[model samples]
Target: MLAATEKALEAEMNRLKLAVKTLQGEDKSEEIYIGSYLLARLEELGVTSMFGVPGDFNLGFLDLVEDHPTIDWVGNCNELNASYAADGYARVKQGSVGVLLTTFGVGELSAMNGMAGAFSEMVPMVHIAGVPSLRQQATKPMLHHTLGDGRFDAYIKAAEQFTYSQAILTNTVSAGAEIDRVLSDCVIKGRPVYITLPTDLAYAKISSDRLKIPLPRHPSPNNADVESFVIDEIVKQIAEADGDVVVIADACAIRHDAIDELKDLLYKTGYPVYCAPMGKSAIDETYERYGGIYVGSISRPEIKEKVESAKLILSIGSLKSDFNSGNFTYSIPTTRTIELHSHWTNIKYAEFPNIGMKQLLPKLTARLEGGKAKALQLEVPRFDAHVPQETDDIISQAWFWPRMSKFFEPKDVVIAETGTSSFGILDVPLPKDSVFLSQILWGSIGWTVGSTLGAALAAKDCNLNRTILFVGDGSLQLTVQELSTMLRKGLKPIIFVLNNSGYTIERFLHGKERKYNDIVNWKWTGLLEVLGDLDGTLSKSYTVNNKSELTELLENPKFAAAEVLQLVEVMMPKHDAPRALQVQAELSGKTNQYAL
Candidate 1:
């Protein structure tokens, strides 16, 4: 009996000693720091760079990111720009989630608008915020970044409205699981997620077992019977129409990582495929059957006619926002439409839940008879820049967009800002494999400048062609400070600042010449030097006031090569706007019941 008691006591002592060692973080064989684990998971997900502004709460966590071997920390000028940059990165780097790091309270709150835009547009993003320690929260001490009213949950509550999933890491045991769950939601749903990493938990030790296991990247598999029924119904619809079907691809098709499947479907079916404005580069434009953009009433005459007259419409991953659909002017009835979504399918009036397109598309493609669509006699309008013959020096909106379109190259990433830039680029066709990004649904004015930085970085990662940005002078002023961040990172992007004096889109909407539409003018070309290119070695700037000067610059081989950061201040009439914008603004004005 005495010997057995002694043995039991020794076993208890050993257990206590091991517990103490874990508490002191000395046992390193099976455990890893939470911060390092998070970074590892991100690296596995193809996050080569993270965008954010550093702060006191996140400083320690930033230290881990700095020590990381692969992931580079890209410090933005502010949190909002950081969020926008992440959005741009996600758009260019399909199948990869953009990671954003920010501090608690003020920092995270500032990034809310950008993340909200991502949620609205279905971009996959992970927003990681470093907050105060758990002990500090328990004591309820008033911190500098907090609201000072001691309502610690207020900020996170605001995030819930915009984020698809959220988590606060208070316990070390469940931190890894929580992270995996939230990030999985972001990827599967293609929306932003919020995570709060308390300062104390940054170094908390957790089991490293989960690191070896891969996170679930794909959505839950659909029910087999339901999926088959959905596909059968779709095929029946197409057969009933005698394959007089037209396919319209939209933003979610790209966001949900269905581009390859979509391409296979389009190629096999040989149907005339068109894209919405947000889905500009969803299909390879070089294909013979690839039609131009279809923006409802604003669509080019030939495209609008071909699409609306179809006996059946296969709308893939469509998000018919106001601007995308020309102010809700889509004339196609639901009975004539078959919609494929990430999580569900709608065949005419019948809705089938739990049937995701990712799983159903491949099966559907296999079942369809190839090249049946070739029998349909249709003439897809030839989409070209079509620069008009001009007699004068001024570069009108109509002249500039088509002229600029000629400068794009295959594999380029083009980012157009809201207002004139977004609407103008719609009429021009990009090169094969090019990527186009715009905030048509969100309509944030100054988004392109910051997004350009992220897109250029992503383009470099993907080994794509040049990154181009178009923004008006008025919109540029809001987020122009991000230019310095771009210069600091040595990113090479072609930035075209449309030097139209004020808010041209706003002027067209409610105030033709009102003071609210006016803004302070700055020397646009001198911005490169002011932003940090002191000796002009890192960047080149130009001001083109006439058609010939701009034409010469566009034709220059060196300029087209994108060897260095370049900015062109293309002067235009302040009152001028794209035809699409004029029509959209008028529609918007009437909808708002505003007197112009």
Candidate 2:
């Protein structure tokens, strides 16, 4: 207890010391360049690489990035892919915001789709754009990248709808402070922001004194009386229940950096913990008390029944999007749920405002440890389910997913596209410390390819085992060029191409046999040879049309433990879909959510 208190005191003292230094404007130094300052801040936040493409407007800033000591510039094929890569990096790195750079109007506009997804999913990032000089803005000159209408503020206006904060560095005097403000908000809100840096201002000198200031990393919640009463009432609520208590971990656990706190709470209370699809990797999946994932109609039978029939449900960081909640299919009423969020929490429809989960959860968890509970002893259901045989030449969905479960190792990062791959992974149990990456709420198909680039880099920095990606053939065709960039950086993520030959997810959504769902065939197994390096060295690629072939490859020691890039094209029937996907489609179709 003394050691823990001393650690807390030390952290508080360091925070105070930094705050005091910022207040005094300690010994202004002329040693900082604007671009250098940006890169330095990122490096301090544990960011090893910045993702973007080099354009003429942003080339000056790239020069500073190139000369930086620790930060590397990861140039992508285009702006949109760069944005996707940054989003993935932020997701895997945990507590660090993604950084993306682009040129003025054309580049920023093209990358808007990626930022929109970030906004919808609450991913943190800083999107910087290199615009024309301040002189050109004053003269209203028609720039090459602009619409020739001389409206300089047009793009930033569009960006405002998609970002939490937006700023244009028109003066060097305020550039440092403005940058700090925007970055502070990005980290605090866990949302993307937009900053337009002028071409000429990229080289301006700035004071580095502000670097001494530290952002408030932890929340200092208010309403002490409300907090005390709430926790007591929460305990009472649980004790009042007759049957069992459960915790539903959601995506914001990852967004708000509450994984440890949530885990501590569950462990202390000894309650069964189930994860939403968006929160798949947030909790310790290997935990003995872990129930499978729950998402309304699509959830596994055991999970759905356990969660819905529980005496009380405690949902932490809940976000129920169309895809996440199985199109509003959750059976638990608000009266039965105790929903805790970062800022506010509610119990049985009673609101407690001005309380932060980052600060409140630990108290609640500790309070439950020694306190008596009605349902102190509970048992989670054990499933001895069998994996069915394929009984055919092609690898079926059931056979492929469960087979890959044993292949996963600890500390690995797995990314699945927003199609059959994501739905198929719901049943497989991941290895300990493995991170799951997906954009389900946004439902972007090809986001995984670019995100894999960023995720692989992050995994390498943390010395994780592997960065694996599961993408369908149709989705891969959208942004497959990122594979070349991955090769350029020498990142070796295990790529699994679910080669069903068309938009299988879309077919389930609206078009079962529509011509719009079909795509042109590509030689998936020969991609490495086409995108070889200057030395003509190629990564390994394999095509598997039979179960035995895939079994042999997965069982091979050298293939399972890979050092370079490897791609496996797994063939299955075009109409094959995961059970979850089929259930979700039936629900949506019955409600006319998708076209007839």
Off by over 4 Å in 1: 1-29, 371-376
Candidate 1: pairs in clash: none
lDDT of 2 at 125: 90
Which runs in model 2 stand beyond 4 Å of their true positions? Answer: 1-31, 371-376, 383-385, 534-538, 593-596
What is the C-alpha lDDT profile of model 1 across 74-102, one tens digit per residue? Answer: 99999999999999999898878888999
Q: Model 2 TM-score?
A: 0.94
The clash number for model 2 is 0
TM-score computed on alpha carbons, candidate 1: 0.94
